[model samples]
Target: MMQPDTLTVFYDGGCPLCRREIATYRALKPQGVRWINVADARPAAGGGTGSACPLDRAALLARFHVQRPDGRMVSGARAFILLWHRVPRFRWLGRVAGTPPLPALLEGGYRLFLRLRPWIVRRAVRDKRAAPPG
Candidate 1:
């Protein structure tokens, strides 16, 4: 069971970009945070320290999601802000981004990025495949 103050992060492990970014965060060893890979068939079933996700697997996989210690679900840019605040070196960025206007602007950018993500991932995969092995 998770502590009352623990935060849960749900992410799409199937996406290469998501995997790489989550790996970076995991490397940081952020405190009081739990990472869940929604891409797995049984992600919410005995996968972490908490109960099953309140949202369905598809919904969880579709966007960034974070479960606050208060049991509130936050998504998109706001979710990112919450996550950043918990990360050691990213607290300042989170605070700034959470400031008025910035959150709205960031959400807009995130939406655009989501729309372009499929194309971006395809191109990245192609490029990686074309690159010569070292």
Candidate 2:
């Protein structure tokens, strides 16, 4: 059930890919969706509470996470499922993916991403550092 109240999502702000994806979602201004940076455990510049999800910073940063209305914390594909429900544009995805078989598939993919995340972050950082400042 999508709560009209708020969904606190914890993400890795330090990761370029994570930042870009979150920025896209933020641009939509999804209803009741609060973005938080795991790196600092602070609400995004947009809005929300500074301390919402009471979880270890390292665990939150290690994977995608979301704090449900009931205060239950979910991670990885499950977290994304919670997130999609909050965003109108992606609600369908949340429904379709929530069903059997789909969740397993999504979780598998998410796990793969987790394994590659470090390398991806490193490459992005290297590229950014190499770019000549304008």
Candidate 3:
């Protein structure tokens, strides 16, 4: 299997809300990351696709997940923190999140995000496929 340094962001490509954020991330940070859409995680692509392991689409869509080099899986706020820490400018947010209170705070915030996630998900599903980055 091919893996890159740092983090791999497995997101719901079908989610407009998610894709909008991904699009912003793509525009702002151009290094130190590989963004993988759950829809694109086909077995032929060497990424987890089917209901095996921790990479299936439905599972991934439920939350943000990051696969570390050591094969550890971090999800939700921790996953976002790992990812935010990698972005050039937003790395500080990750640092802050790693702090005791901040991660906890983010977790609380993540719960809220999930509470509102279904509404967000519906909006995202309504979004048209965006142009792939050049």
Candidate 3: Cα lDDT at 122: 67
| Stronger candidate by TM-score (1 vs 3) | 1
Q: What does the lDDT come to for candidate 3?
A: 0.75
Off by over 4 Å in 1: 41-51
TM-score of each: 0.91, 0.81, 0.75
Better of 2 and 3 by TM-score: 2
Residue pairs in candidate 2 whose N, alpha carbon or C atoms collide under 3 angstroms: none
> Model-by-model lDDT, in order?
0.87, 0.82, 0.75
lDDT at 62 for candidate 3? Answer: 82
Per-residue CA lDDT of candidate 1, range 4-59, in tens?
Answer: 88889999999999999989888888899988888764644544323456787777
Tens-place lDDT digits, model 3, residues 15-133: 66788888887888746676788866665343456423465566687888887766677889998888887776778888887999888888889989988989877665555345354
The TM-score of candidate 3 is 0.75
Q: What number of clashing residue pairs does each candidate have, in the order they appear? A: 0, 0, 1
| By lDDT: ranked, best first | 1, 2, 3
The lDDT of model 1 is 0.87
Which candidate gets the maximum lDDT versus the true structure? 1
Model 2 agreement with the true structure over 43-124: per-residue lDDT tens digits: 5343433575567676777889898878888999989988987776988999999999998899999999999988988998
Better of 1 and 2 by lDDT: 1
